[model samples]
Target chain A: MKDVILGIDIGGTNTKFGFLDRDGISLVQGELSTNEGETVHDFLRVLYQEVMTKFKKIEDEANLIGVGVGAPNGNYYTGTIENAPNLKWHGSVPLVDLLKQYFKMPVFLTNDANAAAIGEMVYGGAKNMNNFVVITLGTGLGSGIVVNGQLVYGHDGNAGEIGHTLVNVNGRGRMCGCGRKGCLETYVSATGIKRTVYKLLADSTDYSELRSVSFNDLTAEMITQAAKRGDKIAIDAFEYTGKVLGMKLADTVAHLSPEAIFLFGGLVRAEEFLFDPVRYHMEKNLLHIFKGKVKILPSGLGLNNTAVMGAAALAWNEMERGATA
Target chain B: MKDVILGIDIGGTNTKFGFLDRDGISLVQGELSTNEGETVHDFLRVLYQEVMTKFKKIEDEANLIGVGVGAPNGNYYTGTIENAPNLKWHGSVPLVDLLKQYFKMPVFLTNDANAAAIGEMVYGGAKNMNNFVVITLGTGLGSGIVVNGQLVYGHDGNAGEIGHTLVNVNGRGRMCGCGRKGCLETYVSATGIKRTVYKLLADSTDYSELRSVSFNDLTAEMITQAAKRGDKIAIDAFEYTGKVLGMKLADTVAHLSPEAIFLFGGLVRAEEFLFDPVRYHMEKNLLHIFKGKVKILPSGLGLNNTAVMGAAALAWNEMERGATA
Candidate 1:
């Protein structure tokens, strides 16, 4: 009989699930639209039914070991999802209790970014690293810090909010969704890049591509395309974004001194265009003592499957901890 | 015979030596001028001569287990002092090699900030904490980060350079002694606060008792006194410094998520004048998850003797590690 673990990645729009073995090979992958407007109980019922039906053929052959879940605002210590802004859930939801009724197995839950970090540690580029940071550059910047071979959850499971760190105190007036001003997320995220484009357009008289595109319609893909075609304005925007990220990274390095910072998500797909500038500026800003160290690498796991793998890795980590004890 | 550990705190101006038992008691304490301008051999000769003469009466009665030295830029990984800017030293000075000639015992060395953190962990406020940050707001804003009960030393032994972290990107053009602009040390340290007062005098019409003091004569002590006397400008200076510190601390909290941050140095002696504003602004700037959970505590160690005690504790930590290994 084969033993399998259930990995669940919960998002605001959709939820992804996978059945995996010890080697991280997925036997079955599935997704379902997350009707966050519905009650938590109703959403769970539908999810459970779908999962049970999908695994019915292999239920007898495969022994289920545990379940791991990655969700927004998930607290590893309390096993609850706190007031997640994107979800309909208003307060702390006891996810462990709800999952226990369905799985009758050991379950683990952590914030999505942290799960991604664990994934990187177990199955990705950070396999040999003792200290590193995983940065997800999406609509907002999300970070997961790994210190001394373990994720830093702090006393209240609120560690690794590096995106909210102030990069510029008075450079921009764009308010972060977190109610903070001039945060790193305000200048480096996908939304932040668009704002940068608008600012650059306003500051420079360059015209070629993206001049006609409204600020609301500007996307990261368009910017990448423009840069590939050698648009100086687009190139400048990327350079500006990377410069801000690098300077902020220098400050982070001064504090924690991680071995590397792993870039993930859509913005990272630009690769050399974004990474070269980030690395160049970071090295320039770094202190003499910390020079020529700390690599900035891209996430090894594919974007579609990384979250699910990370979620599964969380369960595996807990299972190993239980065995060690 | 009672067992004692010799603790040595090496400063640019003076060197303090003390003998401590496991119970955190100081048996004998002495001080000597560090004449760093002299050759390394001469400096050690004087240090050893003083130690032998001072403790000769009870030398045979007490068994010395080890020696610990703390200096401006001491490295734990390699028992050497690397080009401390405050001292007249030029290159890497192997302090352990010189000390070993005098005493055939175990010796450990670390920078002053790391030594203080170990002191707090072993004998002071952070005795029970597995994670914490000790900030020394002296000539510079030195920081020591403890994660999961161990000090975080990066690729090089220069991990905790929190002073170099930029706090104000555009607030002022004051260049840091580190050759950087707007570093946290440029606004929070004793030197930093003086710079702030000077800037305030030049920019603002706010008048106080501080106006009469020249830039060379202006000190953090004077600012504290003026704040105590309800001087608005002095109070505003503290407020401004705290605001920058608190905002940066929020980012720090997000990175490591320590249980508390221990503040030390002459500036911290202002107590409520500094701490209240720091606390207020730290809370205001912190993410909701960490708003009231973490603490900002004043150092419990006496300023007069903390340096020696901290250096001793560093030796104690090394001894404990050796014993376990």
Candidate 2:
């Protein structure tokens, strides 16, 4: 039987699962609603039932190898999911312990951003790079830094927190949900783009399709659509967001000197509208020594497949390391 | 016979040489003036004479294993010093090729900042760490970043040029020597401190020992002495410098997440006057996830012996790597 591994991507809203083979191919994929019930245990029970049913059907054709998980606040060192913001789970959840009961094999877990970095390294754009950084711009900004061909997990597995670096010391102090002021995420995320649009609308009399949308009603897709149609206000909002992000990226490049920086997540889909401005400002702000050298590219893996592939890559990396040792 | 390495520190004005054992113990150290009137070939003749005298004296006591030289624009990949700004040498000086006439064994060359990083890794404070950054605050700011226990040499072997990163986009637009405007080095170096002192003097009519000193006459040591004696303007100069450095460091930490940052060079002698303010602002600007976690520490190695020790460490590292490979 061919060897297969279980890959899981745990989100606050939904949990995605896939059966991945040795060659980085996914045979089946499924998803379930998360945080719908009162407790994490309730969600786990239903998730296990669905996974078991799926696995049994494939057991005749594939041999189960192990399980890997990617989630918010997942700790590679401790195998637990700590108190992640926006999620109903309050305390440390022993995810590896719970998953062990379902599959009796080696299990690995890491933060979602880190998992994405591993995915890029193993099967996507960063396959040839030994050092690179991955930035995920969604509802919030997330990052995973790869140094010397390995993920950097500091003392408490909280090393990759690039989103929280302050870009503007005195300009429009927006409080990040992380309790920080003027963080990169405060000006670069989808939430940040909406904030910029609202601020621009309030300050100027610029007419646009987005002027009617409420704060809760505004979405990144709408802004991208309007910008594509030559909406001045929408275009300005993306430019403003990209400038802040590019400046922050310049500072990051000075420190890491990575071969490349990979962008992932939903907001990156805006493509040229966001990337052109970001690239221009990043090069403009970069030091002469690093200018025109570092490549900033989008992740090649699809959203649904990347997380699962990354989780599986973590197990594969561990296995390789163990074999070498 | 005991294994010994020749350590050479090539400064723009003077070249220091020392004989060291594997344990980093210096047997003998001396300095030679690099006469500006002499051509590159003439200067090497003088350097070789001094090296021969020292080697002859110790030839019976130790076995000469290798030679390592650290200089301003040294490139490890090419083993050459390329267009060092302060030195009269105008083009690529193949240092390893020159050294081969005297020693037949391995000869290595790297930039001074990288040498200092190797110093910390082999015999100083960073012995236990695999990830850290070393900042040399001398005439100008120079840095060496180590990620995952290896030195990062970019495509052109000119990585770790953090000082050239722009800290202020629209503030004082001072032209950097690198043909850039408002670089971090333009505001954080010894020259930067003097500029700040002059700016402070012009802004305030306060009594200061610094007021009478001309820009060409002022020195970093004098500024430190005045700040230690409660000179308000002098104290403020250091605080201003530290604030810029701290904010820039916060941005750096967000990218690499190094375990610690090591400071070296003559300017770092200000110690508390500079460190206190740097520490305060760094902690203040850091993300909550990294606050109070990373450390800012002074170089444990003595200034008088650091150059030779650092060069010696480079030789040791090269030898070890060769053996392992």
Candidate 3:
């Protein structure tokens, strides 16, 4: 039987899972509603039933070796998901411990962004890179910093919180869901771009496709489409978003000096609209030594199943470490 | 004979050297003028001669096992001092290779701030800490970030350049030696504090002891003394400096999330005149999860020979790594 590891990516809406071999080749894939059950235990029970049903069908073909999970606010050190705003769970959820109750193998967990970083290292462009950063620009901005080939969990297992860093120290810029004002995520994420488009519409008298769209109904894709049609306000929104992201990225580069920075997630679909200004402003603001050195590139992982692959890579990395240790 | 490590700290003005046992106890210490020699080779030759004379006196009692050197712009990976602005050396000097020729033992070279971080890990208050940061606030601000018990040398061996991170993204701010404007170092270092005093003097009309001091004659100590005596401009300078430092530190915390940030070097002597405001503003700006968690503490290494101890710690750390490898 072929050895396989189970990889699970938990989200606020849907939960995706897949089984992969050591090579990161997928064997089976599936999904379920994260909001299905009332409690975490109830949710795990449903998840266990679904996994067992799937495992039985593949048991004769592939032998499950271990499991890895990527979720919002997942802590690699504690194996818990703490205070994740998007999830239905209330407090710190012992994800690893709960998963262990159903799976008779070693289990590992980290935030999705960190999992993506490990995926980059183990199977993607960063396979040869010892240090790099992976930024997930979804509805919110998330980051994972790698140095010396190891993920920095910090002292509290929650080190990669770049989204929470302030953008405007003095102004009441934007209200962050974290109950703070002017967070970097407030101006850089997919939601942030929508927010930007609305602000631009209000600020300028120039005609644009976005003028008719209401904030509650508008989406990032609408803005992207408008920008493609040469909508001035939409284009300005992307520019402003990139400018903010680039300035913060310059600060990030000063601290980590990573070989490259990988941009991943839905907002990355905007492509040049986002990358161009980010690259320009980042270079314009970079310290002399770091200039023309750090690469800002698209994620190497295929967009379709990147999160699942990342979770699998985390499992593989841990197994390799266990073998070596 | 007791085995010892020869530690050397190269400064713009003086080069200090010391012999330290594995326990970090100093056996012998001496210094020589850094500007005495015409070339780097001449400087090394004199340093070697001075080291030999000192070694000859202790030959029967102690044995030198290895050497560690800390200098401005030192690169751990390249083992070179690359275009140190403060040093007389004009190019990348292969310091480790040069030292290896004279010392028949292993040698290592890294920036002084990194050495100080290793010193904190091996011998100071952070002995148990696996993740921490050391900020050197001398004429310029320098930082060394540690994660998972290893210093973050980055891909280029120059990861920690927190000082160069921008403070003011717009408006012509303080000019930096790095050809950048509004860098964090321009507002937080010893010279930064002095500059702040001058700016305060210019911005405010209140009478103060610093009003008479010229820019060339102003020192950080004079500012501290004046602040102690309740000089308005001097006190304001310290407060402004702390606010700037604390704000930048909050950003630093977002990236690394180190257990503690240790303040070192000349400006640290200001004590509460600096620490109080830094603590206040850092807390005020820290992200919710990180608040009340990261400690901002004074360096545990004694001011008299901190650099020497740091360099020696680097040698010891490398030796231990070599043994394990």
lDDT of each: 0.84, 0.83, 0.89
Cα displacement (angstroms), candidate 1, residue B271, comes to 2.1
| Candidate 3 C-alpha lDDT tens digits along A1-325 | 9999899999999998898998888888889999988999998898888887888888999989889899999999889999999998989898998888888789999999999999898878799998999999888998999999999889998898888888877545799888878899999998999888878878889998777777888988888888888888888999999999998899999888999999988877888999999999899889888899999999988678989889989999989888311
In candidate 3, which residue ranges exceed 4 Å CA deviation? A323-325, B323-325
For residues A1-325, could you state the per-residue lDDT of candidate 1 as single tens digits? 7888899999988999998887788888788877843788888998998888878867877778999999998998888999999887789999978988888888889988999999898888988888888998887888988877878887667788888877755335568887767778899989988898889999999985989999888899899888889988888989999988988899889987788999988887778889999999888777777888989999977766889999998888778768310
Can you tell me which runs of candidate 2 are displaced by over 4 Å? Answer: A36-42, A170-172, A323-325, B35-42, B97-102, B170-172, B323-325
Maximum-DockQ candidate:
3
> Which model, 1 or 3, shows the larger lDDT?
3
lDDT of 2 by residue, A1-325 (tens): 8888788989878888888886789877788897656787888888888887788888888887778799998988789998888678888999888878767788889999899998888888988887788998888898998877888776457778888877766433798987778888988888999999998988889789898899999998888898999888889999998888887788778766788889898777788989988898898888776789888898967665687888887777766667211
Residue by residue across B109-225, what tens digits does model 2's lDDT show? Answer: 899999999888888899988778898888889888877678767545777777877776633467788776888888888998998999899999999998889999999889999
Best by TM-score: 3
Residue A177 in candidate 1, Cα distance off native in Å? 1.2
Q: How does model 1 do on interface RMSD, in angstroms?
A: 1.5
**What is model 3's DockQ versus the real complex?**
0.83
**What tens digits encode model 3's per-residue C-alpha lDDT throughout B89-163?**
998899999888898789999999999999998889799999999999999999999999999999999889999
Ranking by DockQ: 3, 1, 2
